[model samples]
Target: MLTLLTGLAFGLSLIVAIGAQNTFVIQQGVRGEHVGAVVAVCIASDVLLIGVGVAGAGALVAAAPGLLTVLRLAGAAFLLGYGALALRRAWRPGALRADPSGAAVPLASVVATAAALTWLNPHVYLDTVVLLGSVAAAHGADRWWFGAGAALGSVVWFTVLGRGARLLRPVFARPGAWRVLDGLVALVMVVLAVQLVVRPVGGA
Candidate 1:
């Protein structure tokens, strides 16, 4: 029971950080487009990563520096592209409407984007598979329970983020608010991308 609670708290602490995945979820939630799908994908992905980590995938990934390099570069490229799009949107603030009535972003696109953001981001790998797995290892026999707790944390966090974003709809209803939000999102993506390139994952 103690192991479970520890895992839950640890997982929440790691994921609560502002990251690409959370940003996308918030954007989708605010737009009121397929919030449930985005949340589900994030939760499922976290669960899978946590399981893989607990199963010892972290050691294998650590041994393979080349794989990390490839993922790092690819993730950087993807982030830069996404950031460019956000920057463009911010530049043309008129294009952003808080209203869900605007033509919905296709369900398939949203899902794909969510998956890419979650999977391709090296930070997610480092946090869930590497960091969480290492911490879970300390619990020995109770590791699976710890993993379950972490999975539960993911489910709770994403669900709240996706649902709670609607509460900010009134603020987003104004084009200026959207401009600020997208501008921040773009800045975050670009900064993360630069960090990935400048400091490779697992580097000193």
Candidate 2:
């Protein structure tokens, strides 16, 4: 039980950090476009990654420094591209009113973007694959329980984030709110891309 709680706490701590994935999810929630599918993808991806981590894939991933390098490069490119798009949107926010039913971005695009945001980032590997895996391993035979707990954290967090986003509908009902959001998201994406460039994942 202690191990499970530890995993839950650790998982949430890592996940609750402001990052591209969480930001994307929040945006989807606000837009109300494919929120269920997006949330499912995020949660399912988390569960799979954490499970793989606990199942010993983390060791294999850790031993492959080249994989991290590839992921790092790809992640930077994707982040920069996405960031540029966000910046463009910010500069032209007049086009984007915060109507959830407006449906600017297609469902397919949203899913693809969500997948890229989650998978391409090397930090996901470091967090779920390396950190969570190592911690879970300490439980010996019961590591799976800890992993389950960690996966649950992702589920709960996403559920809350996705559902609670609607409460801000009134604020987002104005175009100004979306403009501000896009601007901040642009800044964050660019910063994260720069960080990846300066400090590639797994680099000594």
Candidate 3:
């Protein structure tokens, strides 16, 4: 029970953050495109990474000094670039139009994007594999329980985020509402990127 609780807390801390991938997921959900597929990919990716952390790979990565630095730089770059894009979108007025004639975004593309965003994210590895993994490792034989708890958290969060967005369809239909949401997303991205850059060295 203790291990499960600990894992749940750790998982929530990581997932609650606003990142490029999450912003994209919410946008896609609002756009009425392949939402189920996108949510599935997000959940599955979290499961895999969380499992890796619980399996002790996180400790291994953390022990390597320069590796995390490289990942941090990469993550920072990605966040900043994406943040700039979001800010641009926020400044530019645009219609949220779903093309009735266009085919849905490909499943393969969705899977690949999810995988890249989840796996390539240095923050993900640090949070799940390193921080959460280290916590679970302290559980000795109860590590499996910790992993399960963390996975449960992922399932809960993603399900809520994906479905809840759908439930907000009425609000999203308002042009002004989407503009506000997009602006909020843009602000979140910029703030997160700045936080990442100014974060104390080795803070993650």
Candidate 4:
């Protein structure tokens, strides 16, 4: 029980942050396209990372300072690039159109986007596999329990965010709403990327 609760708390803390993945999930949800598949990918990625962490991979990661530094640099670059693309999209003049009921995005495209957003970001591995794993390892024999709890948190949060975005589709369908939201998302990503670049050593 303690392990479960601890994992849940830790997972939520890390996953609840605003980032590219969350932004994409929410946007897809509001568009009423491929929400389920996107959510599935997000959850699956979390499961894989959390499992790695619980299996003591965190220790290996901790021992490899150079690898982690490289990952951080790579992640920052990817985030900045993504942010620029999003910003361009936001600036491009386009009217918001409601997706027809039952309309869905292409499965392959959704999967590819989800995979890129989840796996390409080095921060994901560092947070879920290294950071969370270390926490679980501290629990020793109960690491599996912590991982279970973290998995539960991931499923719950992604489900809620994805489904909840659909509920806001009506509001998002208005002229300029999507532009504003996407623009803000771009801004957020830029800020995060800049922070990562300028952050002091030993600080996240």
lDDT of each: 0.89, 0.88, 0.73, 0.81
lDDT per residue for candidate 3 within 28-114, as digits (tens), equals 667666777778888888898888888889868878767766666666676666666656655665634323123366868756755
lDDT of 4 at 23: 87
The digit string of per-residue lDDT tens for model 1 on 120-168 reads 8887888899889998998999999999999989999999999999898
Alpha carbon deviation, residue 51, candidate 1 (Å): 0.5
Off by over 4 Å in 2: none
Task: Show where candidate 1 strays beyond 4 Å.
Answer: 101-103
- Structural similarity to truth (TM-score) of each candidate: 0.96, 0.95, 0.81, 0.87
Best by TM-score: 1
In order of TM-score, best first, we have 1, 2, 4, 3
Q: Is candidate 1 or candidate 4 better by lDDT?
A: 1
Error of 2 at 39 (Å): 0.6
Clashes of 4: 0
Which of candidates 1 and 3 is the stronger one according to lDDT?
1
Q: Global CA lDDT of candidate 3, please? A: 0.73
**Candidate 4 lDDT tens digits, 42-157:** 99999998999889887776677677577667667877877887777678745345442345558898778788778866677778888888888889999899999999999999
What is every candidate's alpha-carbon RMSD to the true fold?
1.2, 1.3, 3.0, 2.4
